[model samples]
Target: MHTLSNAPLRTVVWSTGGVGSIAIDAIARRPDLELAGVWVHSPEKVGRDAGELAGGEPLGVTATDDADALIALQPDCVVYAASGPDRDGGAVPDYLRLLAAGINVVSTSSTSLVYPPAYYSPDWRDQLQEAATSGLASFYASGIFPGFGSDQLALLLTTQSKKIDVITVTEIALNDHYPVADVMMDGMGFGRPLDFEPMLKTPGFIEMAWKAPIHLIADGLGVEVTEVRGTLDRRVTHRDIEVAFGTIPAGTCGAVRTRAAGVVNGREAVVVEHIIRMARDVGPDWPTSEFDATYRVDVSGDPDIHCAMNLGAAEGHGAGRAAMAATAMRVVNAVPYVVAAPAGLLSSLDMPNTLPRYAFE
Candidate 1:
């Protein structure tokens, strides 16, 4: 671990679209981390000021698509919120370049990058491990639901019990779109047979994207995943509405479900399920249909424990903007730690305890 110092860390963000905007806002508000520049994927945004694009106060830095420009800035750390899970292949090469140039990276790419062999490219893993040998400075990738909620929460729950038998984590997103149907035949397993654009509204895709989350938790908790299975469902409604692309039938729902069992010494000990519903054919009300994302964590041991959290964009903090800020903050916080660890692929679980990485102040 690197020694703590009085000087604030120098950093830059590597994104310019969708969720990237949220991270940029968080960087502007944080005092301990400095936003050195911005990188946008859209060619049209290349010359615009970062603030105008992100809707924040102008810091004089303009958005650019050029990686060399970001490298020339001599940043101490790099916050990687650019490419999402599906686009990981496009982003890994850049990350490798950053590591070779001695810059640290943190990403929210494919879930399997947080684990090994279960879903990731073993060759890529080997490459990153080799890069780690270059120095302690490393790379990290996280899964939103599985990485933070399922895996981290499971770890936190274990602190409460000496004897543990089963751990389960479930996440349900009511209105958000997941593309399960489009990818199921690709071996993601049980999802809809919908095409790409429509698949985003499908259910099982979320579980496919998050498979590693449960796997990571089981591994971190000293257990083995013996079996992985899943299911997906859609809702039917009586109302219809016009969408930007077209019209969705009034009674329709796209859902996905997964049941994975991990066994230790021939006993099922861990189970994880991810459910997402974009349009419910039946609902409590129009408002509940428009709003409401529920999450729960249940751990069975000597004393059963559970955590049920209700989140509504009603307060303006959610998977939308708040998630952006949280994601940005996560990347910013990871910068310092990544800079000091050996490179390649790394996750929060792989972190050393003494690393002084974040300051709420």
Candidate 2:
């Protein structure tokens, strides 16, 4: 959508998932932005007010599914919650069109993992990149995990230490209740027996997702990774556990354990451990049916330091629709910076902290 050079950000949201809804709620309470409208894929929600989907009374904005109608809104920015096929690997293209149409954008689509699409799918990278620069529009993709927990942001934040030591990040959560189909396959290591330990080198099924994130961290931290290793635990059919998927043994977890290490000039200094789920993985021996996460950072520097940090998000991954909705609104709150950011594939670490402090309620 087009915007006058001086007007406040006119933000349009493309979906009302969990995170998107939360984000919309944030925007509904903010006075700096105009909640352009809401868009959805299903017709059932087409006429409902965005406030209802979010957590408010009525903003008068109705949900619609037409992409063209959304672009016609001429919003200053767009928050995308749609992923993969819903937009047919075309959401990035839509963002480019929005920029070319003079609207900045932010999204949580996994595909936007890194802007310029070239990083994952080159189908529309240059087109979007060109528009981002020429149109002076912003386009960003971020998530609590890959977007923030991965390299370029959280990992890079450790560069201020005088000396170097070890870095370990673990994302542990109870994930036996998720029901999405697409995620069931890619995100959850389904298909194998409910009690199988996923092979680390199966070629395509390992939790190797940490490689790029760790590599990015290592490279930025001045370390050279000689090799990366990943391990996966698939729940196997057993006699002790019983669910819709049936019984599962203890030797396996529908989880992936990956570690990426880098040797720095003969001195091994970089290591990353990505513990996706612990119900049957790393923490299986500790607890079950509980939501928990911990991030550990240990660096022996000038004064030598060791810190262990944990964030619990077990109820549900905020990104799973509900989380994205909240984060989307937060993204809307960061419009100015996301727009003013340098024209390129920008990382959250590179993007200055601009959003207002989130109150812990």
| Global lDDT of each candidate | 0.59, 0.57
Residues 1-361, model 1: lDDT tens digits: 2344666566777876545666676666667667788888878888888777887777787888888989887676776765533566877677667776666767764456666445546677676666555644567765446556667666777778777788777765553322233233233322223332343334554444556766787777777766554444334445553322233454343344445556555776766666544444343332232234545678888778887655557432453444334445555556666666654567667775322244544
Candidate 2 scores a C-alpha RMSD against the true structure in Å of 5.0
lDDT of 2 by residue, 1-361 (tens): 2333555567887777666676677666666667888888778888999988776788889888887888888777787776532443557667777777767787777433432322444556677767877877767766655445444444555756766666655444443433343453334544344443333435643324455455556656756667555544433323343322443344444454555555555654555555544234334543232334445555555545555444445454522343233345445656767766665455454577655633432
- For candidate 2, the 10 contiguous residues with the lowest summed lDDT are 235-244
* Runs of candidate 1 exceeding 4 Å displacement: 1-5, 116-119, 175-208, 241-247, 279-292, 312-319, 342-344, 352-361
Off by over 4 Å in 2: 1-7, 84-90, 111-118, 122-124, 152-160, 176-179, 190-208, 222-229, 235-253, 260-272, 278-291, 298-306, 312-330, 357-361
TM-score of 2: 0.75
